[model samples]
Target chain A: MAGSNHTPIKPVHRARLDNIAVVLHRPHFPENIGAVARACKNMGIFHLIVVDPLDCDLTRILKMATHASEDVVANMEVYDDLAEALGPFNYIVGTTARRGSQRRTVMNPREVARELIPISQNNRIALLFGPENRGLANRELKLCHTLVTIPTSEFASLNLAQAVMIMLYEIFTASAEFPPDFVPRLASSFELEAMYDHLSRTLAKIHFINPENPEYWMMNIRRFFSRMQLRARDVKIIRGICRQIEWYCEERVERLLREAGVNRVDPEGDCEDRFFGGE
Target chain B: MAGSNHTPIKPVHRARLDNIAVVLHRPHFPENIGAVARACKNMGIFHLIVVDPLDCDLTRILKMATHASEDVVANMEVYDDLAEALGPFNYIVGTTARRGSQRRTVMNPREVARELIPISQNNRIALLFGPENRGLANRELKLCHTLVTIPTSEFASLNLAQAVMIMLYEIFTASAEFPPDFVPRLASSFELEAMYDHLSRTLAKIHFINPENPEYWMMNIRRFFSRMQLRARDVKIIRGICRQIEWYCEERVERLLREAGVNRVDPEGDCEDRFFGGE
Candidate 1:
């Protein structure tokens, strides 16, 4: 749009997509698996390797994956040993969403993709994923050649699936933007809006937060995440958190009612979940 | 090191060498899969699959892999449609190097691998890899259950095989260190470098400097990069900045000279570079 004619956008040297694999270690939730499958399908990365998970079944996972990515759901490789699962690649990069050790290298999603793509041209690349509750151990990270971490707020731990999607999407988009520096890498406003919806809902579910007088709660949570300036992948993770909370609450309520031996109607107190407030 | 209490670190999944298949998707290089095979062999995982690889040769890849890992290279599955390749996976996760749109969920490499082993126990799991130049596209990432990103540097990217090895090593280590809260999921020193690189290069490339020196005569540049306390990635990024500097100087020399390029090669003056400088 500027009056000046700019330099022609140069085509960057993008490595061809090659033998790429993702390994999941000891995952806890099935829904997360489904969501990850959907994420892989969205990014044209269909290889899903699940190593020694807490649960292994296509049942709940399939429902979570929806329909389009049933193929990924259909073909998953399971291995008992993490080493066995990873014995096929030469190079490895460990990823963490937050900062811990000073030994490993870190990058936001975009940079890792840019760096990994070129070297992967003639090799098999395997990206490892840990379980839902926690992430890779320091020992695990030590085994790999290079360590990586995603820049995020200290407390803004992204859901397992959301982390995957953001990193993959960034890499793919970065690579897809053929002419380097030509196409803007920033997400459209629409994408950000979808994320906001997910974030607001997720926050509502996690704590004993009451929207009626929810002052510092939202601000603190938003403040925490906002400090990170959450990107698209982050939003997806927040959405997953909502799903988890929704599931957890449902399960907790059912169990409590079952223990009570009757599904009594306690609307007055039940309607208001005073979880953390009582604490 | 601790002989009395130390046992050989156990593999997460010992290779059963049955009912498993490893597949590669349009692999441009052979070494990555070979490395994957090496990882597989390490933990007793012995199934290999390749999908639409530009070239499929074991020797080229096996060179870098360990002695026992050759099996991953031996058993390979090839396919055209990734969906078709991973049609049987009960769980799926896509590895990404970027943050995608807010559509898909994500996971770090550790979490994904952590979840994989158990999920694949009773089911067939498939780990998919994209081409070399560009990783799995956005469409591909969406295919799997979750998007997985192996943390890498903002500037110093990893090779495809390297990404695989890191994920596998985590899976292997995670098995033995099964403490509930033992998993260390946080950014490593490498991550800091990437962030620093981003900040530094953006400043340098944009020429946010006082160009009166006719050289790189500004001290803000040094102070800026120093203030960031760069990681390995930052170092690479600074190199990238240096690389881009020449191009930027050449292209915008005329324009910048009229505006600012009239300065010398020091963003900071020689006195400051040589000794204790100004604020």
Candidate 2:
């Protein structure tokens, strides 16, 4: 439990939070709406949409929302229909507590928060919360691109504002960028392909690999190098070693021929026989 | 986005929840107390303690606690003093909205929840919340071993129940264990040193590294291989390659010497001269 005094503070991507709109579909209580607004404001979310609420009493809502979240309540949009409310958003995530055969795909809030980071860059995302008494129906869920469930105990029922608070908390926390551990740009596919080709030829020339079915041995070589995630400089270093091996092998063959007083020789065929003869 | 139908549900450690108690110090409203109780029950935390409340009406508290959370309200503890209320708990976390020089060690709720998992296993942990108008004072915070602040926007004021809900939600969700992604045992320092030594000799024999200052070049090589986080099997593979290179260099030098009718030769000196002479 070290103090966070030494820990670096991560920068929050505020624009992502701005892109998220909290839509309460068919909410039953005005106090819950106000509470949701406060939760949204607490987590840096401003867009609050209420669709066809049973009660839209501003006094009760404002009471729970308090003065701090009044702006969220002031600019909040009220819609007559759920589909019309979600029309402007590019992506919709429906929240549900009920699990059924029909609701096959359900993600937890943390996973949804992480996944939304990329999508929120260019899209308006809506987090749709259903009425307190009954969660989003299968019909309403159909409009959603994804589904999220807040994990709870055997008493799995959560308050409307509580659910909203949890979901928003995750998004707000996830929006922060972790302290960077810089990894340099790795070699491109084209550069890697050329290096691998050069390595294949050099290994064959040295009789370190079978010329026949070279691809089989190359597969293992590829996996090994892939794990390294070699940068361009590493690729160049590997290629230089291959070139050196080729030069050494050619020079040895020429020196041997001169010593034996042999004018002509199939270097490849002769070297293969001489290298593998002992084996 | 893939459907979570394939995602396995993680089991929540309920005993951890049982170990957590939510303490309200000098609360203003009974409604907030009731809401906090519901929030605790929603997230599987049952223990609720109130200390020197402005008002503690059972009727008003029960109204917000709802029938679902009645059991939590029935077993709630009330205390006149904060210090006496926190006596049974081994760890006390004070929540604050204000940041100051004295309160330099503030953690967000998520970090606190994650940290509490191990501590909660053997000890009782208390999450202390202050009154609605002013959060925990510096004097009250002194009683706490650690301090946590709910991260919020410019409008930092958050409802008491919302704050309680967020803290409990984090604990409940974090209690679940994630699916394991196993990493095999890596090569020990002794094994890695052996591989590096073998590699150094093999590279020198092939004239791929400068023998005069091999360690300088070996530093870069070490960094490259370290990035791969080599396993025991990977170390074995690398050592095997070094052995192959050593055998190839030796075989080539031996055959060349025999053909030249040399009974014994300074292999290292001759190889160095022959290899680097052209360069």
Candidate 3:
């Protein structure tokens, strides 16, 4: 009976296959575009939107696509500005090849997915991909609600179609949850704000952060850590680091006085005695 | 009563975190290496090991690390070969950034995590992160039993840290599960394989694929499809497309014969007669 109970899991796999859009920006090669279309098809992602795509024949790329996925190439919409094109979607994330000083906050695809998928179910979801030559511009990324970068080696950027396939794959994998055991445990938006507070408070205590004009510092730190989709313990560990730093700093003044007076310290005795009681 | 029975989740979210090690074979950038450390720490991942990293220095790069995650940079390990370092682990995933021409099968991070996390809990897990310049060379990836890549955009390539964080996050997320009602459904491995086979065979039959000397065509198709990670119904729809193509092809041949003088009358009455006699 138990053996029979393990039914074939087809429906479980079909969750969230639709209601998703893959938008490409300024792709140069037609073949790569075709390949991405094919990849989308292969993955059950039919919505393909190309923003400022190069002047290339869809048929040529479609030729490269598998018969099943060619539909993606056949029915792709083209737009000029990414900001204007991706406006309808409730959630949008950009893919970056490397880290930028300005937009340092980047989260794993799974984390991005966990955060976005719930909202996607209710509203249209769009994932904007940049060019074959240069990735999404800083301006384009700013319009996005979130930013995600695939981890890779420093040199040798992945080819266009290949990049599309990878992100599509990540979306597929991150979205698929096993009903019996795998529940989504992503930090909600409010929790994210709380974590940000913890990070800022800790940074303030250390004096590493300027309280008066901490302009981009907090935003940058917030970008990186927030992108991490941190749980509560992660916040706690970060808080501990701040607490430990402050604790060490306060002890440092007493230790400096003891050392200046050439006081010999006891190894087996009190650490406080060495600092405050002239060693 | 059900609501009252629910208990608060404790903050010790350490079980899913692995002693993950990034074994790079000759990294080029000090920044990329630093970024990898940042990526690890951001995801609440702390272990980092580099094998023969090129032109390395942790002091200069640790500034890029945001918090206690800098410890990952501080405690980085450098090794000569993989086996010497990897002898301590049971689960291993090698990152492959370079596109493969020979049809090498690479699992996306989700599947790799599903396979690795359970085994790692029983043993120390070592994830292989290749050089920042050329990804895991094929030889390096061969050392790993399983190969994985982070999915990016169509023309996208990623830095080493991004890939590591994605993999680690997936593995970490899989282990952080709740009870029965929480998990969403995902397609099983068997269904994914079946879908792959069906898509491949159907594509072959269509004129879309060259019947002669089908070199990397099938492979490219498979590679693209493999990235899709299709759900069961997604596969079913694809299979349905294949069946429609077969049906259309049969009808098309019959119409061509009528034009060329084989049938002339254009048989149309009985469905069974139309099917068999169309030949």
Candidate 4:
């Protein structure tokens, strides 16, 4: 068995972890800093940024990091300002334990993880964790485009390293195995608007819609279709049906006028004027 | 508006949070213990347990905990053993950052939060956290009926206090506003089986089931029905339809046999035997 010549093949590179940076903003403890570095190593994330860190011992950081993650500790970057630290990254996510009335709704780690995969493909992403004592300052949080909160019991005071681990875990799990893309691209707003306009005019010409209360009924129809994530092809098909119906009804009206043998011009199918408040 | 006498009415008692305990096993630092207590207070959890903690300063714990969480720190209980600490609790959840081959798949915090709401209604539940150096021991993990791991990158190290806070935050958010219950109580397994037996016999009597491979078809039918969360009322209605179909078919068979003039002894019509394999 020892002499067996079987070699295990290395996994093909996905490089999801390569573009991610774990940024600890104003970390208080040296040991916490070391733990963050170890966690980054565990998750295959090499870049670590400690912003405006407290005066801490590198020995304490390395001790907690152990030999396995010493490479991460050795290559860690330090910055004086949050903006400078985040300048290289395109996508930024801030983690906070507290909620406020003015703050945007936060995504849970799992949701963020799945979302970051596509973002990480072409751009550098930063995951920001705040200090142990009070979490990120409001000014620092303002720089982030999105926020992530770990769901906890009523007492949401988690240690800094734990928060870092949760975020990394989610991103790793999401990146490791991608889910099948079942969601199709939806129609753009312009296409949907054109379809709606065609439908409204067709209905009015056929007198299926009441000109007096067209707004109310049209609004209801818009609501119904908006709920269905219609595709571009679906919008075009619907518009085509509306045009056919309009043509069919108008042709029938012209044939009926000719049978009557009247000299007057056929009734104008422009009942569309009534819908637009006699425009 | 200030002088108006419109005092807000408080919600009625739904003391789900009161029944939960956050247990920390052999927590290394005293400050983390204080932070966890503060988190419990933030989430409305009153009970806390620390098992054989490391020698640490209580002042540091309280100082970090602040004044609002003083009650949590003062009332914290210490235990030498995990089982003794969890004796009063009916449900146990252990938190781990690392997944092992021996460990079961862990629930993400949000999923656990929704699940725990109904559990916390009448049962005493505990959320257990491990020590700072390495997390929970395997022996301690064995005592848990369920495990929760914060999704992290390959590097899964998180600070103990942070882990506690994330867990508490989830429970708190889930408990703060209850989602409207849309799921009805499902029919018990026994009720469902009885309905299936009746249905199979009816199908056999009506000549819809093939005699040679009746089990193969019946198994597929059973699989379809098991997927639906049928209620007791739904089972009753389905059974009624099966009975009616059996009666109509049996009556039609008797009329046909009488006209054929070959019914000196009526065909005993034992369709049950075909379904039950000669029951």
Candidate 5:
């Protein structure tokens, strides 16, 4: 079945993920909603449902979602009732910390993940989340076939996004499905140093850094960047933003000087002096 | 070594716990600090370090802590530098989502827990949690002998408490040392149902539940109670509170009716009409 000179591409197990939906019931915060979307996108689960959400502002949700997971956010469905939202799913799992007589059986996330993986192949599965203040109501939870608790301490109140991420992580890991590796040719130490040096000088020229004590700020910036695990492309993108800012500052400073009727001092020359000369 | 008629209680492996400390670097919220304390107490790790914390309000921390883990909150130590905070510990395990050049080896929490369990027998161990806004700085991470990344999605920003709980969970479960079981003679279904019935009627007598649409409110309360996994003692306490509320409302209604120069209608009679009557 090979082509003339090329091997055929093997298809991934897309069906494993095709049937999973994450449902958030009465989520109060837009940021948590957005973070959930980002997490869903990360684990290759796309379908998202928000039942009677407190806020439906796209801009606010997009703020925490960043630009990467817009597709997940855009395709999200909202419903006024929890039962109506789960109508399409054949298997439903509700998340909760509390346990009661009615709750059939409670399984940790790992066990639930293993159970769901096989069922997910033939049926649509819905993972339900409740609001931040309280977890899934019994009326809402009565709809689910299973309950999964993220083994927690006596104080088991987890933040909403944290709960979403943990459940999705278990499900994704149990399926043994992974997104493509993120190794995109990371920036060399020398390259990263150069970027920081350039950024520091640009900030100094813009007076964003106080000339008197720039070392502390520069050190903090270096420390922050080092922990980011930035790739080569990320460094380049950051540098591009810095360069644009420098360019804006150079022209803006010159205009302000001219408007004030002061003699034009070379912006580039002054920047070089503050950057190389001071150092 | 038996003393008196009671069998002597055996001491647990407290030495393994003695050397361990959980350090929070530049924590911003008091509630998170409280939560970290609660998690530490739950896992039987008591030593806590806060390097340059933003807030140090004991009252606020205790508010979220619910009075159980107060010793942890009271005895927490604070320092200005991460290195100083970790000076007492010989084995430092830093928690981070981000990977860096200097992070010796990135192990998942479970792996880290297993590795640390043996070392903890002889050496002082510190598990570091970073600020909520940004995680541990590269400089702080460089001091760690090992790194733990709680398996997370690509958007791997977990809430401060969730990360702590997950790590402590791994370690606690790995150690096979459990705190006492939280399930303390859970109330039977019939007992819980009786408590809810009494509570609903009390709330109705107090006019807390709207007379117009009481079913929706009662259903919601029932749902809330079911999730609580109420213990027998918990049910008794709740019933007592409901009884008090009913007495207060009955006395207040009689006084109000007398002042209004209206014939006193039987409050319990009216309550029966509203509680059992409405239903």
Candidate 6:
């Protein structure tokens, strides 16, 4: 296969570090925030988003961040809500030290970085970190499509800044080369949440799932669908099916009432209240 | 090729992180020393040597190092001279943020880490870091056998502790034994087919798909689920939903039939044959 005339072709697309936004959720320390900025700049990731920081003292953050990363700190976006902060990102990777049955499908930083190469080219990616003390809670983790755990020794506790540094380091290193496979743009977290909400309501109406504990049952459905890495079109297709189910159920109910010659005061209102209320 | 008896042999030798020593030369702050200690402990590197630190305030260092890393601080070695501090080390890897003609042969942290793994097994390796303000000078870098430079953006400056963290992280990750990626077994073709058949029948009953073109509509669903590589448990969940839909539709029809009191021969039979005939 080795021919003297052979010339290596350059990859058309490479991992876009610019597309990556480092999201720090509820960081307790301003110093860590500054250090995280420094780490972000060092790794060529410019976008930094801080969600509900306990302390937003510029002096303390700048002291650790140094002057080089001032631009990152200056350009940083602050948000009060994690959901709104993650709304624009197409893919979110949550960092966690603790592993559980719910977070079984975790990838190490290196593995995730490699997997993200193709995805970063087409979709905006978010590297989410929880507060310094406790990591991303289960509720917060629900928003993340993928989970990343940094492998460590028995002494597994890593400083918030250190965790950010290692993760960015892996991504920066991996971004040097391009993989052949290309992942197309996936549905944004906003779109996906909307689809899931609609699906939950539809499934609940059909009595396919218990509305009292929808999230419990919905978690499995979320995992199954997340595995598909649904695009915007896929979300639309699923929502379409949910709509059809709603329509079919209501039409069948109306037809049954009409065929019975029941003198119900308002058949449409009764069925609408039961199935399509609060829409 | 058909041999059934083959036993895998474990490697006889592996990298020993214990043989590595982190040497900080003329570090400016005690907090960085403490943070470096923490980084070292996090990655399983125990030996730490500080040569002529600007201030060796134990309290300030410990404050940053935290209680988890007290042992590392307790056992840390302090020296007045850099040469004396690195006397016992056989191989030295100097970390520098600046590049010069003399240090042209610089390897990124990841590359250097891989190279050090084998050497770390038999020889004492020293990872040298200079002051926070200025990196290892030419005179100091002369003592190092290899030079490592953490790749950075235009803002190449990295905190002293952060630099130490990245270097140690690379070495720790390179030395660790990683198994192949964990991929849980997927649902067998038979299980997937059964779930698909159930789903097709359910969708047809709901009028979500035309009965005449059920296969055409299901092709899209099949492709979506195929991407997920559904596990056996996931397949079961989908089938359960199908069964629930069938039950809900039959129950609703029977309730409507009873409420209207129109003499339909058998409501259950009518709905069952229409929605759940094959099953």
Best by DockQ: 6
Query: Which lDDT values do the candidates have, in the order given?
Result: 0.52, 0.78, 0.57, 0.67, 0.68, 0.82
Which lDDT tens digits does candidate 5 get at residues B200-254?
6655544445556666667756744554566676677557545533343334334
Task: Report the number of the highest-lDDT candidate.
Answer: 6
Give fnat, all candidates: 0.00, 0.42, 0.00, 0.23, 0.08, 0.57
Give model 6's DockQ, 2 decimals. 0.42
Q: Which digits, one per residue and each the tens of the lDDT, describe model 2 over residues B173-262?
A: 775774432466889999999999887776665667776666766787788788887878778767766665556555665565555555
Angstrom error at residue B220, model 1:
39
Which has the greatest TM-score?
Answer: 6
Q: Which ten residues in a row have the lowest lDDT in candidate 1 chain A?
A: A179-188
- The list of candidate 2 runs beyond 4 A from truth reads A1-15, A176-279, B1-15, B178-279
Could you tell me how far off, in angstroms, the CA of residue A168 lies in candidate 1 after the best superposition?
0.6
Q: Which tens-of-lDDT digit does each residue in B60-83 have in candidate 6? A: 999889898999999999999999
The Cα error of candidate 2 at residue A260, in Å, is: 88
lDDT score at residue B38, model 6, on the 0-100 scale:
91
* Candidate 6's TM-score: 0.91
Candidate 6 lDDT score relative to the true structure: 0.82
Model 5, A242: alpha-carbon shift in Å? 71
Q: Write the residue-wise lDDT of candidate 6 on A1-279 in tens digits.
A: 576359776554446899999999999999999999999989899999999999999999999888889999999999999999999999999999886656458888988888888889889999999998888998888888889888877887899999999999888877534454777789999999999999898777766666677787677678777666789888888887787666655566666656666544333331212221111
RMSD values for the candidates in order, in angstroms, are 28.8, 16.5, 31.9, 20.4, 28.2, 4.8
TM-score of model number 2: 0.60
DockQ of 5: 0.04
TM-score of chain B of each: 0.52, 0.59, 0.55, 0.58, 0.57, 0.90
Better of 2 and 3 by TM-score: 2
Which sections of candidate 4 miss by over 4 Å?
Answer: A1-15, A42-44, A63-68, A95-114, A129-142, A147-159, A173-279, B1-15, B42-44, B63-68, B96-111, B131-139, B149-159, B173-279
Q: Where does candidate 6 stray beyond 4 Å?
A: A1-7, A101-103, A176-180, A263-279, B1-6, B12-14, B265-279
DockQ of each: 0.01, 0.20, 0.01, 0.10, 0.04, 0.42
> 1 or 4: which has the higher DockQ?
4
| Fraction of native Cα-Cα interface contacts (under 8 Å, chains A and B) also present in model 5 | 0.08
